[model samples]
Target: MGSRLNPYLSFRGEARQAMEFYREVFGGTLTISTFGDFGNPDPALADQVMHSQLETARGFTLMGSDTPPGMDLVVGNNITVSLSGDDADDLRGWWDRLSESGVVSVPLEKQMWGDEFGQCVDRFGIGWLVNISQPQS
Candidate 1:
């Protein structure tokens, strides 16, 4: 029950699709709650995801929710979720999954920074930055 910080994405009405796609890519236990599952207060959004959490064995937690009826979804370039570590194999695997069906702004390759770095915008328009640091000599 410790405090945790994770990215919370906001989608207009594609939260379920995006989250499910993430579950497939990250290999995690995904739990999603819908507005109807709550109390049937909003019939229109009853089927839409009220909240979703993906906790992967890789120790990554991604949470997201659909924007309520009145809320505006302004997915700007203000934020980009970043993944960085020394696990080349694992990180590259994630890069392959994330970069799939999306736009790769920077190809994942050995960067001048001495790491495998790249950036991509997922099909849901979520920006991601992955960096696999090389072992120090």
Candidate 2:
């Protein structure tokens, strides 16, 4: 098997829910572990998702986990995951869902570069940039 790239997201306490939802959206096999499983056994965080991975049938892989103790959970400035492709409709659907309760820095619309682009900070405080190029005629 060849090496692959996947996005690893960090959440304060919503890692489980978020990863589950991604599983639903992408239809994948999901594996999750908790802090307790790793031997921390911190009663407070034992139930929180420590790590989760969703391997989708569509060949997409997404991983996420709750922020570890003392790890800073900040949003919208340092990191922005980007999605770029020519799938306009599919990418726009993602933009709609990602921006539902978040702030949009750039609305998803055709840009001067001839691609539909948008930037938003998701409700979870994760930043995202989506670029959808027009399909060739």
Candidate 3:
């Protein structure tokens, strides 16, 4: 598949509710996973959504996740531009450019989910999330 650009929203505890609302309005398949599904960082957030994906038949893809404690979360800056696909070279090229002169909050590296991922805030203060997915078997 080709690279995708989408918005990834950050919620303090409303990801599940928000994603569900979108699903209701857009009519699509919604998949959600709780923090516990990926080894809950805080017991209190075990039931909080770690990730939620809504893909509509119209080709709209929305992703969101509840922020765990200790993460910097500014209300107005809760949205991130997500770039993801299986093309590592292409993804890395974009990552290099977006992160240059920008603060990389999360260094690009192999994540626990078997993918290379990173998060950064661009020089313009726009947040970016890049994930180089693993090849499907």
Candidate 4:
């Protein structure tokens, strides 16, 4: 497999719910593994998600996992997953789904740059940016 960059979110304790929610929004195959599966000696975190991945039908990838026992999960101001493409239908569909149960920071619409853009923090508190490029004149 070629090298590719994708967002990996860290959740305090809801990694499974959050990843599952993204799967529903984007329609993807979600795979989650728990710390216990990896032989985590700490029983407290045994059921926590060690890694989770959602690969969407539209060629989108989202990866996440619960914060380990020692990591400090500081919400906000650390990461934002961005989706950008020229497909208006697909991008708009994603925007609608993502914002349905979440708060929209910016409504999706045509922007000064001539593209349809929006930003929102999903129900799971993950920030997202969608930019749909306009067709050439």
Candidate 5:
């Protein structure tokens, strides 16, 4: 699939609830995964949302997750712009440029989810998330 951009919201401990609410308002299928599903054994995090997505009939794509432990969740900084798809080359190039002269919070690399993902704050302080989906075998 080609690339797409959307907003990614971060919640302290309410991602599941919030995403469900958005799904209600926007009318979409919502998929959610908890930390436990990813093998996180910590009881405190096991039930917390690791990720959630709401895709509306109008083509709106909303993603979100509960902030992991140890990450500060300041209200003003809880949202990130997500660029995601299966286009690796284009996504990697954009990741390079977007991270140049900026802070690379998470290096662009293969992640536990079997995809290449990264997070960074642009030079102007806007946050970004790039996820390059790996082709299924």
Candidate 6:
């Protein structure tokens, strides 16, 4: 699929609820995954949303997740720009440029969920998330 950009919201233990609310307002299909589904053993985080997505018929895509334990959720900085798709070369190029002279919170690499994902804050202080979807075998 071609690359797409969208907003990713972060919540302090309220991602499921917040995403659901957005789905209601936007009238779309919502998919959610909890930490437990990913084999997180922490009882406190098991039920928390690891990720949630809302895709509306109007072409709007919203993604969100609960702030993992130990991460401070600053209200104003809870939103991030997400660049995602199956285009590896394009995504990698963008990731490199976006991370240059900036803070890389998560290196661009294969992730537990099978995608090459990373998070960073650009030199302008804007947060970003890049996810390169792996091909199905």
RMSD of candidate 6 to the true fold?
13.0
Please identify which of the two predictions, 1 or 4, would achieve the higher TM-score against the true structure: 1
* Best-fitting candidate, scored by TM-score: 1
Candidate 2 per-residue C-alpha lDDT over 13-85 given as tens digits, one digit per residue, 9 for 90 to 100: 9999888866754578999999989888679999888889999776788889998779898743777878888
Collision count for each candidate, in order: 0, 0, 0, 0, 0, 0
Score candidate 2 by lDDT: 0.84
Global Cα lDDT for candidate 3: 0.82
Q: Compose the digit string of candidate 4's lDDT tens values, residues 106-130.
A: 9999999999999998888988899
Best-fitting candidate, measured by lDDT?
1
- Models sorted by lDDT, best on top: 1, 4, 2, 5, 6, 3
lDDT of 5 by residue, 18-121 (tens): 77765654578999999999999899999999999999876879888998989987765656777889979877877887788779989999999999999988
Residue pairs in clash, model 6:
none
lDDT of 3 by residue, 1-137 (tens): 99997778877888887777657645689999998899866789889998889998868798889888899777656567778888798678778877887799999999999999999986545677999999877
TM-score versus the correct structure, for each prediction: 0.95, 0.85, 0.55, 0.91, 0.56, 0.56
lDDT by candidate, in order shown: 0.92, 0.84, 0.82, 0.89, 0.83, 0.82
Off-target runs (Cα >4 Å) in candidate 4 are: none
Q: Which stretches of candidate 6 lie over 4 Å from their true place?
A: 77-137
lDDT of 6: 0.82
Candidate 5 colliding pairs: none
Per-residue lDDT of 1-137 in model 6, one digit per residue for the tens? 89998777777887886677556544789999999999999999999999898998768798889989799877656567778899898678878877887799999999999999999886545577999999999
- Lowest lDDT 10-residue stretch of candidate 2: 19-28
Worst 10 residues of 3 by lDDT: 18-27
- Residue 107, model 6: lDDT of 100
Deviation in Å, model 1, residue 4 alpha carbon: 1.2
